[model samples]
Target: MREEELSPGEPAPRAREPVFLLPGSVSALAIILVLIQFASTMVLNPDGQNMLLYWFAFQPLRIVASLTDPSLALPLLWTPFTHAFLHGGWEHVLINVAWLVIFATPVARRYGTVGMLSLFLVSAAAGAAFFAATTLLEGVYLVGASGGIAGLTGAAIRFIFQPVLVAHHPETGERLVLGRRLASLREVFANPSSRYFTIVWLVLNAAVPLMPAVIGAQLGVAWQAHLGGFIAGFLLVPLFERRLA
Candidate 1:
């Protein structure tokens, strides 16, 4: 009945395409972040560096001060989204880039470029909001892409562990499928991979706040922002995911 039945002598076909590298959007984002950080650190003067942070970094004190003074409100509004693009140092950006490539690839494939962008913006804002709500410290400047990275990680868990449905190709007998279903929070935890990841992530977050004294270094982990971004990504991914046919 199938066309392959009449072509038994023909050579077998290849399997479905696999992504061996980072997608365009994710790669571009990483490059842009690295370039900006490079420019800020190497090319810019001390004043320029301060100016960039003043204009872009999310500052909780400024947001609160803006309540009484209207002029500071613009930075407050934009800083939440802008801060995700900036980083503290080389190590900060590299770690974020790694996480972004790993988790964002699947999200980008499933949700498309626009969806990924939206997720980044919303999650970044949520991360900033959570940090502001929890921290009593004034003049705190939050910078880096970790919130967005955590977001992608959270979003990926929605469907990454599910068993993909496969069908045999008529010509080559290669297996293929449309996509996997989005799993609920409970279902996600039931899977071993997701369960372990969630537990470890929580443990790390809880432990990070105590690392400064233990390590004898000033390590501002911003665990609150990470938690906020993760929660936002986990809850909001369903809205961004395309409906399966």
Candidate 2:
């Protein structure tokens, strides 16, 4: 007769445990990329690695040459997307995987599997294009998933900071929310965490190019790609978002 009382045949509800799980689509893609990088480094010799980079890495010089000569056009066509899967080293791939997991989880949860894949492909291509446009050198190569990860981060900012609707569970006393809504740009900036995140992201991107000189090491950070990907993700999230019912 009591509201919280269980019926004779009913079982009591279990408390929810916080468990961190790798998102399905993001994990699969990240693993594949890591495997490819590992294979390129361990299975292949130095010459083979060079050949792999030549074929898959995005090179602005190749595109420029393709303009003058039609033969180079075909390879350049797919390099934008392919280059994202290739990495310069273990550190590069690992760093990307970390970011991919953090940012892509939110995106995969909000957007369907197809939407996540679409974001990655589009962001990667946009990042490559921007890098090619800004990079002045001829022989430089761009590789890694930083651009795609940056895009995921940008897409996440669109909705992650919004106030969630929550209520105490009838019996469990646990907080629960039905769904989330996108926060307005004003609201996002008004929140200290979101505001700081946006500001820090912008400053980091701006500072990336200078990092090589600052640290006195050749850290080939494609900051242009990061900016392009972030812009693309932030602007394009609306296109991918499900219409509220």
Q: Which one is best on TM-score?
A: 1
lDDT of each candidate versus the true structure: 0.86, 0.85
Model 1 deviation from native, Cα RMSD in Å? 5.4
Question: For candidate 2, lDDT tens digit of each residue in 1-245?
Answer: 65787889898899897575877898898889889988998899999999998899888887678778989878788999999999989998999998999899989988978888889888988898889888745679999888888888888988887777667788999987756676667877898888899889979897987887779886578998898888788779888877554
**Best prediction by lDDT:** 1
Q: Which ranges in model 1 have alpha carbons more than 4 Å from their true place?
A: 1-20, 167-176, 212-217
- What are the TM-scores, per candidate, against the unseen true structure? 0.86, 0.85
The residue pairs found clashing in candidate 1 are none
Candidate 2, residue 3: the lDDT equals 75
